[model samples]
Target: MLLASAMTFSAGAVTPGGEAETIYYNARVMTVNDHFDITDAVAIKAGRIMAVGSHAQLQELAGNDTRQVDLQGKSLLPGFYDGHIHVGTGPRPFGATFNVPTPDQLTEILAREAAKVPAGDWLVGLMNRPHCHMQMPNRWELDAIVPDHPVMLACGVLKLTLNSKAIELAGLSKDTPEPKDGLIVRDEQGEPQGVLTMGARRYATRVIPNPALSDDSARDNLRAQLAKFLPMGVTSVNIAGVRPNELRLIQDVYQRWGDELPRATLQIFLFPGYDDVDTSLAELEGLGFRTGIGNDRLKLGAIKMSMDGAIAVPDFRTLKPYDGKVRFDERGPWENQKGDFNGVTVIPKDSLYRVASRAHELGWQLGIHTIGDGAVVEAVEVLERVLREYPREDHRHHLHHLTIRPPEETLAKIAELDLIVDTQPNYTYYNNAFMLAAVSGNRLERQNPQRSLLERGIRIAYGSDGLPHGPLLGIWAAVNRLGHDGKVYGAEEAISVEEAIRAYTRGPAYLTFDEQERGSIEVGKVADLVVLAEDPLSVDPLRLRDLAVERTIIAGQELFHGSHVEPYHQRPPTP
Candidate 1:
């Protein structure tokens, strides 16, 4: 447990512990502790929660100099812990430039974006199709838009569509041999169609010059991303897939703006193709980093690995074939097709097992990205094998995005192995429609398997994956299971609002091994919390996403307040 008890202070008295700071009171606080206790107030000192009880009780402990704010009956809960997020690349570059719809809309957006850029400069865009409530653009469509400029657009996973210019620039023609873990799409004429799937995208992307951004520019972009999260009441995030350079930049900014920024948990997964298993682990260890290092402001968490691709793109290694429709003699989409389906492991399974086993031996945790059933099974097998061979207790290996598992049996194995499932319920709501259309069809009932996993005693955690990383949005999706066409996909699999909240907070914390300090709002833990406009449990399921955030506080300092409240940051005593 990474939690500490609140320091005791006399009622109506202030203790000058040098670093002790401000406190808050007079709020409807729901501390999702062992008892699921709800209280009227909370007190803070030295960036740790002091007391959690009635308003009268907490106020009695306030010191004469302690700056106090009345919550005025607003609702407050622990700040959200996002188990999965791609943070190293920062926010998507096309965030402001595109309102990506489906394939047609994406084509339109690309054409418009291409028109704006100069002729020769590479035209790059990221489209979130799995969750983007739209159609996916293909390589042919991209070619039609910018025939001159080399264009590369990546959909949610590493799946990419490239134009003729991009293919030519990367020196990939019909005869270009596919890389070990990648695929090159070709037309019926046996010519390259410019659709680079999975690992192949890396080749083209590497050749394209990265857009230049100064430190100030990077900070500005980061601030914009932070602003987006603040309103949604997200105070902390586990940034997935970050390189050392980006990590350094984030660390520099965080140290300088420690007082103002949101509490962040930085999980720097080595880039997929850049670093080998030993090299990556060595780099992480060389930084003098541990699984959970840093104070309330920022911390380094687990190492991440992508064990497979996504199912929506049909590259995920699935037991059944996705033939665009049900057929008697169907071939698994990626196997016989132009695409590859060895399932693009970030590192070889044996290498990943070795590295994860080493990490476990060193008291670190591992987070492996597994999307399809095969991928999930492979990941679980690896973890199980490593645990049995190395015998580390409380390893807490996490399987990210277990999108399409068969049933509770696999989850039961997970529970038995004590592995954690870091899932994204928001994907269900956002991708339900596309998933129904492209991959599973009526089998969508088997998708996600949240209810089944919970029932089987599997430890399940929730994350947004940032396509739509709003906790409220995720809560709504879990509760309602609403599809794109306004129909509910699997109501039976729908979880309760309370369960959903737990998955986002307590569950994720446990997965990250930070349950003791941050997940629940108990006395003696770090004072990282969110003040919502309304009680989530009390709101209608459909209205969950509509519920607004009134304030966000981390380490006893307010980071975001309602539009009506004043902005401020408090520091400990200087003496």
Candidate 2:
């Protein structure tokens, strides 16, 4: 088996170096290389780009079996790469709930879902963003809807809102003190308010029996999610924070589906609270998985760690207190005193540093989730210390969601350390109101710091964070720098469409150390590409999200083709 594996690797490395089998012609293809060149056509053979040049130049290599596809004056480009994604988790129950903008919407959604589900069963909802009109619902509201069932709604970052029944089921009460590195929000009456932060929620969730998600079910759901991404021109995603069981499920899908599993890299983060670093590392080694272990279809990339909470929840480690206004109530005073708010860190800085240092020593890349200024500072500090103590070449430690501060010194240090910044630009659109009101306030002008990071030559990448994973929507948010209400914040930090594209592609590839194999449309690279309805460069920046995907090809196989939704046919439709 070892000999066979070696032979296969050797064979794959040796390029076909032969005639082309297919030619895409008469279109603009953005290579996204250093030259930033656009070509008229691209030729492919053996699931690799054979040549990229004029339509006629590449057509010369085509034989009688060659397939020709005319772009009809449309656009073709390297598929977008979402730098950070929670891929193992299944789809959120969006349609089951109401579409309103406030907590009323959640109430309506819960009421509706409760009606459909049998009594005394768990009712789970996801994708609840804080700072929206739909403020995080409390246990009281959930109890009113489904008093018998245990309802758990995950809202922004690692916070979970549980119904009174859920608390009872989990045996959580006023006497149940907050766990280390976790928070349990209480009402003014000192009753458990249903909000469980960080490790506490995970603990409660583990005890409650999950709705039996099988590997087959997970695979099917993943395919559905991938289809949604392909239409939006997303070709690749980095699955951040996957556990061992979820990794097995992903591997099963990849083995059966092969390249059809979507252009992706799976980075399994050992949840610090669940597994020891040594045990997790041993498990990865036993699976024969090292960083950058597979083809473009799937690969083990980095180790992820969620260091802090999100800004919208006001739990993020901030350099200063949240703006002097309540997040849910506008006319109220700030929640904390006027000073530096350390925010919440799921793992202590010292512990996080130790974990990262161990991973670094073992030559594994590190990806840390840092949203608050304090979290960012702590992460950077730890990374710097680790590098100095045990120097390793090409240590690509990433700071995921550098939301609040782009401190010039820290940005420069990141560049110096060669660390990557994984940012979620779409959140700017979905949570812009919350950002402007609760997090930034008058300092909204200095938020994000995209421009500052770029100026310091920091490596940056863009991701949707999966609540909304459309590349065009992310690009629109970056280009516009405005919220839904037309209020623009930090206009100076906004980036061009081209730069945003680079962040989605090359930047992420560089971070994962997969730049050589993917992230661009070039000869010898995997044939993972997205055919677009309109030229991204030529389209109006404001209408970028309007652009649709014509098709998505992964390893020269058409995985998803754009077409109108058709009704499900049962038993041949009575033919």
Best lDDT among the predictions, by candidate number: 2
Off by over 4 Å in 1: 1-26, 62-72, 89-118, 128-134, 271-289, 323-348, 406-408, 441-443, 563-575
| Residue-level error in angstroms, candidate 1, position 478 | 1.5
Q: Rate the local accuracy (lDDT) of all candidates.
A: 0.68, 0.70
- Top model number, TM-score: 2
Query: Over the stretch 125-236, how does candidate 1's per-residue lDDT look in tens digits?
Result: 7655543322334456667777778877766655666677887788887777766455666666656766565677766777876666678767766656655666667767
Q: Model 1 shows how many backbone clashes?
A: 9
Positional deviation of residue 229's Cα in model 1 after best superposition, in angstroms: 2.1
User: How many clashes would you count in candidate 2?
Assistant: 4
How high is the lDDT of residue 96 in model 1?
29
For residue 481, model 1's alpha carbon misses the true position, in angstroms, by 1.5
User: Where is model 1 poorest over a 10-residue stretch in terms of lDDT?
Assistant: 566-575
Per residue, candidate 2 scores C-alpha lDDT tens digits across 65-88 of 889999888788887788877654
Which regions of candidate 2 fall more than 4 Å away from where they truly are?
A: 1-18, 89-122, 126-134, 148-150, 273-289, 324-334, 337-341, 441-443, 563-575
